[model samples]
Target: MRRTTFIESYGATCKNWTWSWSFVNKTQRFVIFGAWQEDSHHIAGRHLILDEHWATRIPKGSTKARRQPGYPQAIEHLSRVAEEGYALFTFPIWQASVGKTGAGRDPSSIGRFEPRLTPKTLVHEGGMWWAQDLSVVALHSEPDVQDDLADVGAPELGRDEGHSKPTGPGHYFPRDRKVREDVLKKSGEKCERKGCSEQLRYKSFLDVHHILGIAKSDRVTNCVALCPNCHRDAHYSPNKDALNKQLHAYARKRPSN
Candidate 1:
């Protein structure tokens, strides 16, 4: 589909004729951005599974001209996606010469992008918002053409040093693998839930569930062993948060030794 059709399909209107971003559909609660494949704007590095799309590095929100008219709303939609765990869409765009319109960047393809909360991708620095780390999983064309790198025109963007693995959010702390192993082993190969009789023939049958998610420390006191049924309930149940709180309370009461 063409750029206008794609954006309009998502209940957004396109304003700029040459090139633009921020096709935000407030009602739909989603944002579709035009991602540039230019080397200066994107990093499709070999080391990272996700590609990084960056906004032009300019001071924002301080001066009237510095704030791109569409930026504030677009940023709002993107932030909502991140906080609410919604997907963001990106259409691959690049400069091309057309017979009547002359030369300009246009969206030729589309892709799915995952919103991340890492400082590099989403941040408010010096009282202004910065979008330097938009992450693209893969790009798809009309005929189901999937390009992992999204480096059709820019080859140098995949240089080894250009990209690295994505980091967690500020509150995210890495958990220790050894702590998980110890917690699982200490559970006696059985579900730790109170009054539950599930038993595991092998250690792998029990999952070492993190009571407060992996973002918190992976100490034995923060982890619990559960059978598949209990594990699923802890994650997918309607009262998952309540179940998590119960599990954490149990973990805290049990002896760490």
Candidate 2:
């Protein structure tokens, strides 16, 4: 543990305050202990600062803010202070909102101290990171519950069972650009029709026809590249099964070279 100071600025008064002194180093075991202040301005934009050597345990929703070149210089300064070896603690204070009452205890009652553990609690309960934390905060203010009750005309949940009509020109997959590049490369840019040595120049004139005609059966062994003329002949020819057998026999007899 070591002592390192962090300064936070107050927008209203244009004055800065020395916020916390924390242990920041390469050590593995660390705990961030702090109290929440109801009226302190620094709470809204608060974060735990760490040097490169120290790993940070940021609660969800906190991100590393953008920094200037001098950020590394500031880290170096903190590392030097940490070399002295002292236990570190951080106290985060939230700046009260506009026209809000300032930080002080009420005159008639004793103040109770509580841990700010809602964010950590929701995370451990296997909830979605953003939505859970938001739900907790909304519940704290009670407005979310009130709003849900006030919305009487909201749509019923999960009742839609109607079938959707087909729209025009739906694609099973993309036909343009790079779709045929790998297919041509695998089939050697030549039509798979036997004894047909015509090189395929335009992929648009070619189609990847499945041997089984089932969309799910798209394995390489079950497909072949065909020119439009050969493709139409395969489907419309009077003896398609006999013609396919002849084509397969011809393709087997020809050498790949």
Candidate 3:
């Protein structure tokens, strides 16, 4: 399990806190004590910024941003230091577990930190930065907070069932369970797109689509059942004008119950 040590860093008095690492390295086992820069402060120039993707520091400079130690470190209860705002929390980590969000600092630009700028959530620890509290969090907490990290076009986990992921509101139809079932039933458990024989496998593969468009139609008749592939094209394909007409005609052909 990971451990957290809360620290207080103020501009004046508590600027320089101390840390020591003792272990047998490839060179030798030795102990060194020095003033460590907590959270908002970096080792030198590296700025610690949080990647919204997986809420981590995939951009190489992250290790230097979070200032995490390799081994477990603790703070006593009585040793609590008081400050007006902003507390730095330090912890030990398994370096391999660090998350990668995107193609970090292109080419040869790593380890360099600008002296003037201050870091936000990440601080360099063991020569890398780690993500702390996300900037867009507090209102969106924990699991929902993780949702923000996933890509807008990412696939759902339960493909055969209800879509549990957030689809960009204006682009995709809402995950209304009743509407989903109604559309799937109308299609006779098959994809409504012409030439597509794909049967409804789950709530996800067979998406309940809006023939008029997700952003415009609220009427149930405007919706239809489409396979994932056709559904994607219906919204993103450059030839949507023709495809929308086809889907609208297909859905309207069914007699009203």
Clashing residue pairs, backbone N/CA/C < 3 A, model 2: 40-94, 40-95, 41-94, 41-95
Candidate 1 to truth, TM:
0.38
Q: What value does the lDDT take at residue 257 in candidate 1?
A: 54
Local lDDT at 51 for model 1: 19
Which model, 1 or 2, shows the larger lDDT? 1
**Could you give the C-alpha RMSD of every candidate to the true structure, in order shown?**
13.8, 23.9, 20.5
Per-model C-alpha lDDT, please?
0.47, 0.33, 0.37
lDDT of 3 by residue, 1-257 (tens): 10112221112122123322211111221111111233343323222322122122234544444332322221110011110112333322212222333333311122222122122232223333332333322222222111111111334432333334433221211134566567667788888888996995653456666665332333457776777677667765788668878888877776662
The better-scoring model by lDDT among 2 and 3 is 3
Residue 103 local lDDT, model 2: 28
The true-versus-predicted C-alpha distance at residue 143 of model 2, in Å, is: 56
Native-to-model Cα distance after best TM-score fit, residue 111 in candidate 3, in Å: 47
* lDDT tens readout by residue for model 1, 71-188: 4445555555443333455555554444422122223222333232122232222222223343332121110111111212233444222224433331111235576567767777
lDDT of 2 by residue, 1-257 (tens): 11122211111111111232222333422222233344331122222233232222222254553322323433332323222221223334343343343222121111332223222111101111100223222223221111111111122321121123223321112222232344456667777877764676653445554443321233344445666556655655676666556654543344441
In terms of lDDT, which candidate is strongest? Answer: 1
Error of 1 at 102 (Å): 42
